[model samples]
Target: MKKIALLLFPFILFTFSTFAQSANEDWISLFDGESFDGWEAAENPETFSIEDGKIAVHGPRAHLFYMGAAENHDFDDFVFKADVMTTPGSNSGIFFHTQYQEEGWPAHGYEAQVNNSFDADPRRTASLYNVDDNTEVIFPDDEWFTMTIQVEGQHITIMVNDEVITDYTEPEDVDRGTNVLSSGTFALQGHDPDSKVYFKNIKVKPL
Candidate 1:
């Protein structure tokens, strides 16, 4: 019995160590907090700025794409999360399964709408844009809220402050030509000049 116990002890230790290492490796930060090191800004560069450990978006129309050095800044199945805060009447969004665009709105990927008291769009915070949109004003303006998104295969889930909000599944026959869902990098939106939003702790865990 003593010999059997000794052999099992080593095997258990090895298994635990391997699991912990993989979990840590799976998570990667898209933002470094001090600068836009692994990201690319399109259109107005002044729109995106780093202030007080947060990515502040407040100037004009622009989109910041994650161009990090991981898998060529491409992720297929992963969990994306960020701490976001919006001002009153502000509007913004986070895009997933998207690519870099030199000008105009990104033609690819899906937008997870970030809105609080904005009167223009009915879609509120933690919404999956047009697809399975969420209209509840879950978060208050000027306060930070944690938004979490999980995408695996055709399934997509969104949460606000750890509360499940949207659970959507893309149809198998969904068109792939236009706003259809596909694998790509992530992006942060600067909706307009008046809209002020802050984002931080942006990270992802590939599945």
Candidate 2:
């Protein structure tokens, strides 16, 4: 019996290692930390900058789109997450299912509103914009939190620090083009000059 168990142990270890490797392959890192190597910024490139390994969003209105080398910078069913920190009165957002625009607010996709204490927008963090707004503030200002957005087909889920905040399913009669709920890339919003937000460890796992 002991000899048989020893023989099976090696096979079990190999199988477990192989499964772990496959799971890791399903995930991809979107940000390289030092610079915006695979990202594209709108109008003012200065609005998006890397500070101490975090993607700092400040300055005037602008959007940073992910134009990465894989999948043509587009994703359909995937789980995206980032570590975010907001200063007092800061406002920002994480936009998905959106296309790239030269200037102005992203006409395409849905924005997961990121605001803690900003006076302009009453909607706090984890609200799925107008689609499914959650007025309950789940994040704290001047602290780091994990913001996660997961999309599977017509369903969307937004979470803050592992807490589910918004779960929305797209309606059949939704609008088409640039504000539409369709397959597109991801983006980060720079609300205004007064707002300052930090994001790091941006990653995605295709479902």
Candidate 3:
């Protein structure tokens, strides 16, 4: 038993070291948890606020875009992640490959639906909104959950709680006008005044 433990110690240490190095080297936190230094809001700019050390989305229609120094807020292939919590009947979304719009819903990129129990929208959390809409409720409301969106080339994948929910591949002839897949920054949506959502640990890694 002592010999086996000694042999495994080196492997365990090496594994941990690799993980730490990879995370530090690749991932970048988009939110500072205390300020919006790297983020910019559109339309109802007041729709987002830092409360309890998390982004509080509690106002009318608005989109908050990432416009900081990281990659100049421009990403072609990357993984965007955040911890989110939605109140009952709330609606929100995370947009990737989207640019900042002065007003109204984002006109670019794709929306990974952050809705779990919103009675108004049939799309559930982690849905590739419209394009690959999901109606299954995979996670519950009022709880912290991790959502990740990975884009590589023409393929897009969305996960909730580290579980795959939506896997989309943009076709060669596919065209949805401004909503088509393209390289751009990320955005957070404040769906409506009635919906309240929380987001934290926002991060991304360019690939």
Please give the range of 10 consecutive residues that has the lowest summed lDDT in model 3: 174-183
**Residue 19 shift from truth in candidate 1, angstroms:** 5.2
State residue 150's C-alpha deviation in candidate 3, in Å.
Answer: 0.4
lDDT of each: 0.91, 0.90, 0.92
lDDT of 3 by residue, 1-207 (tens): 999999999999999999999878899988998999988998998999999899999999998999999999999999988999999999999998899889988889889999999978899999999889999888898899999999999999999888999998999998799787779999999999999999999999899
TM per candidate comes to: 0.89, 0.94, 0.92
TM-score of candidate 3 relative to the true fold: 0.92
Residue lDDT tens for model 2, 1-207 = 999999999999999999999998887999999989989999888999899999999999999999997678888999999999999999999999898999988888899999989967778899988778878777788899999999998899999988899998888787655676678899999999999999999999977
Clashing pairs in 3: none
Q: On residues 141-165, what C-alpha lDDT tens digit does candidate 1 reach at each position?
A: 9999999999999899899888999
The model with the greater lDDT, 2 or 3, is 3
The segments of candidate 1 whose C-alpha lies over 4 angstroms from its true place after superposition are: 1-22
> Model 3 segments beyond 4 Å from truth?
1-19
